[model samples]
Target chain A: MVVGLAAGFAPAAVADAYLDMIEAETEKIAGPLPTVVDGEAGAESEEDAGFQEFLAYLKEESLGSYTFFEKLTPAQRSEVFERHKQGASLEQIREIIMERFLKR
Target chain B: MRNCVGMILGLACLMQPVWAEEVKVGEADSEFAVKLTEDTDYLHVVHQGKSVKVQRVQDPNYELRGYFAKTGRKCPPFCLQPMHADPAVTSVGEVEVLEFMENELRDGQGFLIDARTPSWFQKGTIPGSINMPFTVLSKGEDDPEMAAALEQFGAKRRGPVGAMTKTLEGWGLFEAEQKTAAWDFTEAKQLLLWCNGPACGQSPRAVRGLLEVGYPADKLFYYRGGMQIWQLFGLTTVIPDA
Candidate 1:
């Protein structure tokens, strides 16, 4: 499945370049967490917001075909891993494309 | 408004497919569109009709529960609870374990459930426990065995509650046999629901389902340490004949 996704998103030769772009962008936002929301748990606000931004980029960039982390620019992969570590919802991330992410 | 228009356009742009990939996780009906991340532990399982995202922590041994925590965002906000809303079954000490043993397979205390598929039940199950699969309990009269079982339980073709009870009763699943599984809290006493063991949550869900059906909650107990505990203690188990 991973290989299939990689091929569809970026031919093997250019996949590396595509991944590099994602990684760079991911690193930029991850470096600085968003402002903490009042009455919210510590770090969650910033963490969630950062993740949302990264998700938006992935969605707008048409990342549905990307395979594992290899399809992402190194920066993009970093952002995803970073957000996941902070416990972002994978469902919300998927909603960026499938358009079926239920808010309930 | 331009903003609304832009928003719609933005969403449309996002929907454009970069590539299509097939990713199947667990027993889901179909593959889901996914973008994997290193920190995430599961894969998305999607059936175009509906999708349930799962985390594949134990790849070869993955079950839907492991991904429950990941799919919280898709559920109604009210349903989301802290991951550790309830203490781990293993962590609850003996004291906290109000009742941990079953007496007669029929009268046991804690819980003695059969967690396997009902097909497995046709093969056999411990004397007590009602069949409640962790994945999904096949509902509707469409299921012949389930239908026949509920019929035996005196399940009149009423509604959801009646059908659910019939299913349980048909399987002979009651904390203390129908004569005892009553609403009168005093009658409930210490009852447990089980299907398999610590790894299975069917019993817990069954207990919760019962509570929703208006069963007394306090008297209700969850033998989280299910079949595992039963087997460890060297209790009796029965196999059903086809």
Candidate 2:
């Protein structure tokens, strides 16, 4: 009877041991889970919000040139916003962006 | 009063021919009158919210000049492209393009795409054609710009696909020709894409890039002759803002 009980328990114990070994191997391979700091996450979201606002402004005021402006790199887009802040009209911004593309 | 009368007579004489000499397509008195075809007199399309009449120069002496008129270009980049970008993508000529403008384009069922870079496109493009640069289209579907372009071309994102769905697609149980893992092109617009000319690779590359992303082959048409041939035949071109 003792041998019979031992046999059933032995398979269950072996299975648990195999599972434990697999979990350990997987953890070793994957390393630590990345922790997202609150500050970094907040900064990314803030930048995204700013970009979305700029896109909305472009869509509303410069619908004709919006597609071209949307293709600008982040740096280029910043320059365009700076120009706008400095009193450049949408048409002037478009021409400036177009000149840059034409030079390319 | 005598001097005023004489001035009025001179002005009338100048205006007479201006009103009388207005020549309609296929009705020019000169033997050099140009016609698109025996049936087609001219094509009319809308460009930048204005109606544009596309017709050849009536002057028999008119010659193609400037960049398009050149016979040769450096080979490596400007080498002639094949008749077909892909076997499945139909190649079209000027007549078919005109017909497309009259029917599909006018009906909003198709798009005439100028697939050159902005530098080339800004110079001028075929009337009624909108610029969708090859660079933008060839960036792969995963790119945000490319995804936006695909959306503009009437493709919808399918989001992520499950393994079971993928297996069904692989087994031909799903309609796969108009779909990719990323995009559903079931309602994609018919695109007639052109670039510089027969030697231009821009449109062909754009077509191939679209095909790689599983855009329906039937929806893509390549105009291999492009701007060069379009000009050789004296079709109309329009500068975007000019």
Candidate 3:
């Protein structure tokens, strides 16, 4: 009776069975995903905060510089941040931004 | 009898060449001898709310310097482009460009596009050209910025496609030359595009991009001798404000 019932549902049952087996195998090979920690989340937020602070500095120090700064690509913005970290003056940073803006 | 004679003399004077006293450009003996053509001394075009006079540098000793004057650049990126961007598009020279400025551009029937990036544009560009970067155009029609640019060029987006419209478009029934699946370009402006020089690929890329988006080839013009040749000939360039 059981074999007859299995034969009756053969195609779909076999496909589902194969899919389940593949999923099980994949899960076995790939262990549980790593969990995100509060510290990592906090660090990401801190980075955002730092970028905001840099933007605020740009907006405050220079009158029309922020308009040009907004046009910089992500890589350029990163370079600007790096330069700022190295204690480059606002004029130096603006020049670097303008040069990049002009080139790209 | 005297009145009749005077009238005949006045008519003869009126019929005589009015341009006889007018100093033509490139004439044999003139202090400022440099000229664009036999007739054209200069061009007037409004740039950034100011009327700019576009003319060749009158100083006989003036020479081009700086980036455009450089002879060689790496070939992979700066490989010399062909005269025609596409078979259907017309390749034009300085005279044609000047004519275009006087006719189509002046009449608002066309646009002269500087296809280089904004950075290059900021340094300097040909008079009466607006910068439209190849990067922006090459982003594909579906991109919002690209779509906006297409709209600016007078391409209109079609509404949602129905089955009947698709079927007609698929068949030969619909007018397809100026129509794409997504856009209608019947009202698009005639565009003359230029870049750094014949060695530059920016304008060609822009042309290709527009073609891909179903811009009419007949409406496109390629100025192969771009800023480099323009400068080599001592033509005018204007630095755009940031």
Candidate 4:
């Protein structure tokens, strides 16, 4: 029974080792794992150029500017990125970010 | 003749300057410059018994092009973090970081962490820093990899999970009984974390993850001006051997 179990587990262990090695090499060139679970929701948002432009504008707004981006979770932020990519203007995206994310 | 020679040596010693040479960083009036333990070509450090030379490469074959060269990025994901990661966290500059590299890291009192992914780390990184990608520790609470890492960091768990308490472990204390029971925060090693500078959030994310895992705020330091700023001033970076 012991020998049978050991033999059965060998393949899985070997598979895991290979996976580890492959991942190590890939990461050495590519980047870290892009997991939504790296943090909370909004971290995985897509690069919506319009929404991003609005954020850049906000950052330039000198007096007491808020960190509106971090207000939403990664998933919500992804939705915003998606919306901007569709057809929304900077104004419309700003309105949406404020409505959903900004504290009342 | 011997007595006269001794008197002459004593006079020479008295005339010598009391203060060591002052070190000034690149920027003109920004505060934090430091004096080092005499000028040398390399920063020598011992990690796990192997001596590692942390020195600036006189000339590297590569150049900073493409992504790192690009000045701007879409804001939401590639946003600029505040000078401070959190209210309590400390934000430091290259000068302070260099001092840490020369002193604290050399003595093994602290870890100057490069929170970038292996890709970025492999390209080039500050001398005396070790790569510990932020995502690794940001894994789910029950992640075996995270647990393994935390354990290797000398942190032992106590009590329950959510409502649990953990302490930083070290060698035996003054009391024999005090040696084992709980996680010892006092013995926890200092961590200096950084990423691609102010524009990058990777290091901040790692800071947050560490805080969430109950690492002491005081023990965590953010080198806000990371690689971009490091390269801006043309500070040294060492490429690790594959």
Query: What TM-score does chain B get in every candidate?
Result: 0.34, 0.83, 0.83, 0.65
DockQ scores of all models, one per candidate:
0.01, 0.01, 0.01, 0.01
lDDT of 1 at B119: 51
> Mind giving the per-residue lDDT tens digits that candidate 3 earns over A1-104?
99988888996675456334423322232221121112222111215447788888999998577788888655456556655754679999889778666655
For each candidate in turn, the interface RMSD (Å) is 26.8, 25.8, 25.4, 19.0
Name the docking class for model 4: incorrect
Please state the i-RMS of candidate 1.
Answer: 26.8
Top lDDT model: 3
Worst 10 residues of 3 chain B by lDDT: B43-52
Better of 2 and 4 by TM-score: 2
Off-target runs (Cα >4 Å) in candidate 3 are A1-104, B1-25, B28-32, B161-175
lDDT of 4 by residue, B1-242 (tens): 22335777878776766555545443353222321222433333333223333333233343454345557765645678899887777888866786776566655567888887786776766656788887776664457776565555555654442322223233233332222243334455678999987888788878887766666678788999897776654454555545
* Every candidate's lDDT: 0.37, 0.72, 0.73, 0.58
Error of 1 at B66 (Å): 23
Candidate 2 regions with alpha-carbon error over 4 angstroms: A1-104, B1-32, B162-168, B171-174
Which CAPRI level is candidate 1?
Answer: incorrect
Instruction: Tell me the tens digit of each residue's lDDT in model 3 across B175-240.
Output: 767888889888889999998888887898889889988889988999999988888888777766
* Worst 10-residue lDDT window, candidate 1 chain B: B45-54
* Per-model TM against the reference: 0.27, 0.59, 0.60, 0.49
DockQ of 4: 0.01
